[model samples]
Target: MKAIEVRFAKEIDKSFVVFRETGKYFPCPWHYHPEYEFVLVTKSHGRRMVGDHIGYFDEGDLVLMGPNLPHVWVNDESFINGGAAYDADAIVIHFQENFLGKEFINIPEMETLKKILDLSRRGLVIQGSAREKIGKLMVKMMTMNGLQRLAALMSIFDLLSQSQELELLASPGYTPRQEDQLKGPTDRINEYIMLNFHREISLQEIAGVSNMAVTTFCNFFKNQYRCTFIEYLNQVRIGLACKLLANEQNKIVQVAYEVGFNNLGNFNRQFKKIKNMTPREYRKRLDTQLEEDSIFFNEAYIVNE
Candidate 1:
């Protein structure tokens, strides 16, 4: 899709921007910005699209994306449709690479921080104990000011640089087209597919969107995405299916059809191929994980008491 470029409002006193957003749902569209971003979802569950990577995000989901990476978080239907009781909330931090001045990052002491910034170009999901520690630091930064806030940000970066619990989101081969180079044939094709993936899309239809012959379009898509067009479509569908599966209220069959799978057998096969587990198993695992987290929280609270 052609992502819109979003510019941030500059603050005269701060080198970075940190704020908590709360509403019926996240209101951002698919967009890109020049500032690297650190995001922590404090409430809501939804699908997050970062570059060509699609995944489910829940409360406590944290990610860092380098400058100009297209991304958005769309809350679940319940949140958006006013069926949920609580509002969606997130804490976000945005800063340019030179926010602290180019000289500061070029110094020998900042080598690891520079490396982590470079890795973030593909987007990174902070995981394990690092996620918890960094999330706390982010929350603390909301109340901090001046040098204190900057120090906390540096601490978060240091943790990210040394920690082994980082997962890259976008595919290694994926590169976001810059604004100057957008509106190309491939970009149109991507927009069409993403907008219409919930229904049957024919080869001729996609080829028309790309302004190419069917055979030529197939070859071009394979070369550009490192996979067949069908494979890419299935990846997008399965990604959305995952978010739907997270809510146990949705039946597996309904989720499959909702995500554009016309048949149960095909959905099962594709889900297993991409996720390494059947839909039922994936849902069961999510439940088990939630239960474990609740138990851990209760025990920790009791111990503190």
Candidate 2:
């Protein structure tokens, strides 16, 4: 596949397009479009690549990408190999950055909206309460038309602009490049890392995989990802460790080895560095979040009854 992709949306009278995609798997290759996109993964778990950032995404993943930012959600190997039981689904919305009109920012009411659009250049992940509210709004847009649909989209934009839970996905230094210059070595490097993250990987091995000398590979990776190869590898491991910690059955020491850390002390240091908390503390927070969610849901159920 080419590095950058051009997506041409069909002509519609509406200001933006909303699409609900369901299939055995997500088939889109690495690509980018001119339109700014709002994507919600309703079901599926996989590695989601946005520009130079690589991380796993689960159900309810929501992101906004600015014009020309490259991205794709590649489902786990089981799903792609056709042995997965459940199907994958997503709700995607596409629109130009100037969808509200070229002079829309001139209005005093749109200052926050303009800022949000600018931040979308690095891509934003909506989370917490805002994610739940905006997700329902995205679904609601699918059934409405004309003014109603436009109003729904605007509401989403407004909430996103004010959201405190938004997280930027790509690094600050990430910049879009020509298709030919973007896909070759970086794509291969990312795939190699994802596939081998659970095992011990050395600089020489990865550099050989990229067909470059170790020193040359280090420079190339730092230039592209804004971080050294070891740092990126640890980030990936820590991310997976986070997911593993969420499961009550996995102990911290077990998770450390599972994600390729040779020693628990090293794992603890790296985990704390990235998450600002120890693994045990992170798990405790997750437990608290789950308890709060359970209580909230129970109360809502009783109120509805």
Candidate 3:
């Protein structure tokens, strides 16, 4: 896959673009472009890569990615299965940073919005109360026109700026690389890791894939990604484990082995280090939240009917 992708949008009168997409999985590779993206995952669960950060995402996942931030979401097998039972969909909005004119954000009235846009350079996750509020607004915006749509977009950004649950992704000092000199090796390394993270991977083997010796590979990878190779691999494994744990039918021990952890102790330790909770506890929390959401949805359906 190309390291950087150039996306061309059809001519439209609006300053931004909004649309809904449904498919077995997100089709894009690990790629970046010049547009800032706001995405709300309405269905599906998967491992998402943003910059050098790898993590799990599920339904209601809301993320804002800045221009030239490489990102991709590789769906769990359940979502990729050719069945209606496990399809994915999202509402995606794309806009340029200066869509409202370069001087618009510098005004005192838009200080907060300006700050939010700056923070989005490393990507941001919009969560908690803001996710619910902004997500609904985005859905409505897809059906709106002219001033109404622009208002909805501003409202979403306002809520995001004030959100206490806003989380930053990627690391400081990481910038998108445009040189073809590094793109091939980086893409090869990423593809190799994603394909074989379910099995044991060695630094030497990965180094060979990057066509570097062990020591050179270590230095090169750290310089390029700002994270150790092992750290990246563990994140990928843990991300997959998260998707499996979301299914109540899977046991913790089963999920551990399924994602390349050989021992339950190591799995528990690494999972806690990355997710800050034990796998069982994480499952319980998700179960409780899901049940509550189900009840709320049923009541809403009855009221509407």
Candidate 4:
């Protein structure tokens, strides 16, 4: 077992407000919570590995995961790429069954809320009309406490539970797990890579970060993350590239270099490999879609990356 540092949020000692205004990031690393986590992505763009499924996530991404779900919010470097301050961050609210009351569901009073949380176990992603309506409730929760907090929570479930467009993050088994086992090297490796992904990072550097031999480090990381160390690094960089591509102000080749890809051909190839289109085409398609979806995701939505 690796010495994974975990800072767990305590069970709500009677439903209180939990608002986060952080120092450019989240508090805990890749750790799970006993309390359910409802995250509103304010301004992030990167991969979200929930349980075992992997996918790219960006702005306005709201996700809900069950108790003790192994997960993380991999923030792409593009947001902090010496650009204007969009304040790259996230707001996560954690609460336990006890906070909501253990018998709330058993009493039949919280039946609907129970259904919403049940749907969330499979993981629910709010989209379209419901996102705006339900998303506002999250922002409203920030300013609430006591009975008001309970009411806000109820409204959140009522709208989200009824939404048809809510997409399931994955089919299940997200990542098969045994409780006693601990998270190994991948979390530490990814944290280091995320902090220093701008330039070059070598195998020795990563191995040293893991405090292990190169061979052992390689096997440990591959087994945990389901990708070789190098592959994960490329994915992190490419995630940044996609953010840049979507941004529209930057040039294709500059984004290539900025995201740690040295050669233009290699960047184009990798970008096409992961994103399935040339950077230019990817940017074009995203811009077109953004225009079409302009009617959605306004300031009314409350999410911190």
Q: Highest TM-score, which number?
A: 2
Error of 4 at 75 (Å): 6.6
Q: For candidate 1, what is the TM-score?
A: 0.72
Model 1, span 82-133: residue lDDT tens: 9999999999999998887879888887786677777777788988899999
What is the full ranking by lDDT, best candidate first? 1, 2, 3, 4
* Residues 110-130 of candidate 2: C-alpha lDDT, one tens digit per residue: 776677777777788888888
* TM-scores of all predicted structures: 0.72, 0.74, 0.72, 0.60
Evaluate residue 53 in candidate 4 and report its C-alpha lDDT on the 0 to 100 scale. 40
**Which has the better lDDT: candidate 3, or candidate 4?**
3
Which residue runs does candidate 4 get wrong by more than 4 Å? 1-18, 21-24, 41-61, 72-92, 97-116, 122-125, 165-172, 176-187, 193-200, 212-228, 231-260, 268-305
Per residue, candidate 3 scores C-alpha lDDT tens digits across 202-296 of 99899998899999999988988898998878888887787689788899999999888889999999999999999999998888898786666
lDDT of 4 by residue, 1-305 (tens): 22232455454454633465444443355556566777777665666655544455766788877666666666665544535366666556676666656676656656645666765655667777777766677777777766787787777667765665655554444532445334456546756775567678999998998889999988888877798888888887887677667667788888888878888999888888888888888888887887555445332122211
| Model 1 alpha-carbon drift over 4 Å, by segment | 179-232, 238-264, 268-305
lDDT of 2: 0.82
In TM-score terms, candidate 4 sits at: 0.60
